[model samples]
Target chain A: MTRLTFPPALHAEWIKIRTLRPQIGALAAVPLATVAFSALAGLGAGDDDILFSAFFGVNFGQIAAIAFGTTAVSAEFHTGALRLSLAAVPRRGSWFAAKLTAIGLPVLAVGLVTGLTALAAGAMTVGPQARDATPAEWVRGTAGCAVYLTLMALLAAGLTTVLRSGVGALSILVPFLLLVSFVLGDVNGNAADFLPDRAGQVVLHSSWDGTLGPWTGLAVSALWTAAAVAAGLWRVRVRDA
Target chain B: MTSIDVHDLTKEYGPRRAVDRITFRVPPGRVTGFLGPNGAGKSTTLRLLLGLDRPTSGTATLAGRPYVSLARPLRHVGALLDAQAAHSSRTGRDHLLVLAASNRIPVRRVDEVLEETGLTPAARRRVRTYSLGMRQRLGIAAALLGDPGVVLLDEPANGLDPEGIVWIRGLLRRLAAEGRTVLVSSHLMNETASFADHLVVLGRGRVLADTALRDFIDARVHPGVRIRTTDPAALENALTRQGHDAVRHPDGHWTVRHARVDDIGPLVSAAGVPLLELSAEEGTLEQAYLALTAVDAEFAARQHEEVRP
Candidate 1:
């Protein structure tokens, strides 16, 4: 038998990501929705905080990022795709690793582009109000946006793999990101700051009063993503396709 | 040489055993037909052999190693467990391309398999638009993508048309002739009868018979004598007197059970019965299969009755 290499498996997974329509839609919507909403948020800004307004689109754009990651992994659960995939690359860990790479890289790329776009759109719309932000802050926030979104997407991908359904992952994630991050977190005080979405969102803020700083907040979210990924890998290894 | 070896492989889901502890070997350069009724564990066994599902105990191996141990699995074993396993959004060609790319198989072989499977015209169309037959063809094309040495197909002819079925039959024969091992499972006895060299029949997750196709059929189907006598009444009376149960047919022919043509000829002549014509009818694979499964059906019926209120 020919030796199983990583390149071919990675290429095959990359093909799956680009071929499906929903995945493309989710990926495309990341920048569009993020920039669009940031522009709107910039227009309604009251000059209290400028940088946060510029990255405001991330609030809405992250849904698409998570959707992109979730849909990518969830497609395999349907149509006996996992069986075909595992049959080709018999080692479960290698296939999952390739799949995660396929998922993580694209979402990170799109997330970075969306962050910069949202930043530019926010600066243009909320003109002069955004002038208080330093270039270093802009760079940190932009890079942080990309990393945070990529982490969130990986988190969704991991959950979807465990559930083996795109809908199942979306159902749990969408409501948590929307309701918990926006609504419940407001009333829950310091405890809500550590939730995956809220902790990650600290990077988008220009000034913060939370116990966790921007990078630390991202680390918290990273921990959540790592746990989800570890659980997903364990499930794939033990469960039959 | 043995290409596929399954030893005491069993799989259980909760209280139900999907595959019982059973063993068989498929030699190279031949087609082994896995015959069973629906839910008889044929697909489950294939899944276990391919490592898609872990066995409860024992092992299934390819050449001397487990399937998972193969470096490039698709290069050694090609399996088509479900035709609908292809994502509907992807085109037929894309599906095979993904599989080919996974194993580092050249892209040219993808087109070749499409051409061979008569799927060149619909290769670019999304899989959702294709008919069941087209999907089946696509699955077979994927299985042949790597041009692997061992092919395991579960109900390969499930949705094919008559011509498609004939094409698959010829393709399987050609693959086996190329010294590749082919194990195809199907509930349709007549379909497998035309091409299978070996037969492994299963019932209720257990193997009922494992032998060569010819031997399996011969062992189960008893050859009977067909005779046409001038005096039907005298023939019956003489056969009764000679302790032979000659069953009369609606077409004026009599079938002599458990007796050969030679035995019938001498007995009829000695009994003074004029025999106009006599011939021997060979047993068919379908008859043999039905005879083997009739007991299974009866047992199922009794169990059903036992559960009724």
Candidate 2:
């Protein structure tokens, strides 16, 4: 037997993602929409926190990440390509991990760039009266956005594994992100901090004045991501492909 | 020794069994046609062997080890369960490239397989844009990417045109000639009869017959003597008196059951009957398969009737 040393699963995932033009277009939409929408939202408001204003794109961009991530696995299930994937790499865990990694890295990069550009554009339009974000804020916001997008992608991927359908995964994820955050807004101040979108959005603020600290909010989001991924892993491992 | 060894494999869905204690071996250097009717569990069997779906009981080993146990599985076995299972947006070459990468196979090998499977012209085209035959060729290209010891293809001829079918037949023959164990599943026995040296006939998730092609044909098809003469009644009577069962048709030809043409010439000569035409009628593989499956079909119908009534 030939000693197979290729990263076949990872390579396959990359090819799968890149070949689909819609995925790339979706990834690009985050920054474009963030900058455009945030710029529009910041027009009337003056001298606001540049960091906070710049990240408006990520709020919308993360949706694209979620869609991309969900489809990464769900597309396979829908097309029945999971059989070919499993047949190539019988180790289910490795295949899942490779797919996560391939999708996670690109989403993270897109998130970071979008976050940084949004902040810079907001600051440019707001002029010097805009509270200049500290380097620490820039680092935190950009890095946090990247981490947040990665987690969301992973969460979407996990949810997709559980649902095994693209439309089904999206139906659940979109409502949780768009509607549930508002529904939980007036609940027990401390309790609502654990909601994934709430926790992830905390990364946008320059100050840690919320119920949970910035790091704690991010941690809570991470927890949600871990739980979702663990559930997905369990489903993949136990269920028939 | 480097072959697929499936022992007492069983797979169940809830309370219903899809594959029930089925066992078979696919040896190297020949194509083993996994023949069966629709819903006979051919795909389920391949899924178990490839570890896509776990067997409920027993084991399926590839090259003396379980499929999941192999660190680099593609190097051991390559399988194409569905031709259109690939991401429709991905190009054919990219699809093969991805699989090749996993097995540490060279990227150029993807091109080689593309050429080999005759998908070179459409290598750069998106898979969704390709025709069904092109997609099938692409799937085969992916299977051949690793140059593994064994290749498994399920319903590979499902969507192929006549020309494409002939191409696939030749490709399978060439692959088997190179000493690799090739297992192909198809519901059409006639298509398989041309390329398959050995056959494993399945029905209702069970193996009806596991034997060589020639043996299957011989066992199912009975050789009979066809004698055409003006005195059909006399010849029929003479053959029937000589302990051969003969049937006279409305077309004035006599068909002798369980007798060869060589035996009929001497029988007619000795009986003083002038023979106008005497020839042997060979039984076809199709007839044999129908005879074998007819019994199973009847049993299934009776079982259904008992349940419903």
Choose the strongest candidate by lDDT. Answer: 1
User: Candidate 1: where are CA atoms >4 Å away?
Assistant: A1-4, A185-189, B229-245, B259-279, B295-309
**lDDT for residue A138 in candidate 1, whole number 0-100:** 88
Every model's Cα RMSD, please? 2.9, 2.5
Q: Against the true structure, what is each candidate's TM-score?
A: 0.93, 0.93
Q: Write candidate 2's Cα lDDT for A159-221 as tens digits.
A: 888888778889999888877876775354676677887887788777655687677888989
**Worst lDDT window (10 residues) for model 1 chain B?**
B69-78
Provide all candidates' interface root-mean-square deviations.
Answer: 1.6, 2.7
